[model samples]
Target: MENDCSRFVQKCHKCQIHGDLIKVPPTEPNAMMSPWPFAAWGMYFIGPIEPDASNKHCFILVTKDYFTKWVEVASYSSVTKKVVTDFVRNNIICQFGIPESIITDNGANLNSHLMKEMCAQFQITHQNSTAY
Candidate 1:
């Protein structure tokens, strides 16, 4: 039975390329449309910035100015509503004033009504990035 199974496996094309395959490109590579990167003067990415450490909590909330290459990083505890709000309040609103548009990851906390309300109150456009 083992000898028969081995003979059957050897006949399979998928198994034949054990290590001799080179550059087996996708057949339908151009069938999918590639996406262009989003352009925004001021953008923010609200997500986990660093690994969870024993003592320190780190979340990545980055605000970047496209023209100036200026970036602001907001560190928080996980991706919670309070932390996101605090990031906007302390890092965004207080430091660089109000941006025309605010970009954040499509996390649950970031997509909440409270976050929307905050953006509305501040007259800032809130844009969410698509998950790759």
Candidate 2:
């Protein structure tokens, strides 16, 4: 039994490799193509910064269009799902028209029920980021 196992390891190409162990599957490069402006957007939160702004706001919510690199920003004391939804509704949808997709990190405020419902209503694809 021991000899068979030893022979199997010797014949295995991966076992012969002298480098860092690869636990995850090798990933192929994927091109993220946005067909047009306002087609895709990515959202992020800046900080609960020292309330430096004139409005005494501490948090900054910013979203940028993937194609045009156009950005929309707003500041608030605290960020909630309501705040996120309102920002998307007013800044992105109302101003630039509905986007094809919105991608955000898997934040609670970003991936709320309200956001999903809004996306469904607008026919916008909402995706939470995954480790890639």
> What TM-score fits each model?
0.56, 0.73
- Candidate 1: which stretches are off by over 4 Å? 1-51
lDDT of each residue in 1-132, candidate 2, tens digit only: 999998998898887795356786888997765789999999988887974688788899999998889989999988899999999999999999999999998889999999999999999999877844
Best by lDDT: 2
Question: In model 2, which regions exceed 4 Å deviation?
Answer: 1-30
- The 0-to-1 C-alpha lDDT of every candidate, in the order given, reads 0.66, 0.90
lDDT at position 91, candidate 1: 72
Looking at model 2, residue 27 earns an lDDT score of 88
* CA lDDT for candidate 1: 0.66
Residues forming the 10-long window of minimal summed lDDT in candidate 1: 32-41
RMSD of each: 8.2, 8.0
* Predicted structure with the largest TM-score when compared to the true one: 2
Q: How many steric clashes between backbone atoms does each model show? A: 1, 0
Cα error of candidate 2 at position 59, Å: 0.5
lDDT of 1 by residue, 18-132 (tens): 8465777757645312122222334344445356655565666676665456677756566677776777778767876766666666777777788899889988788877876
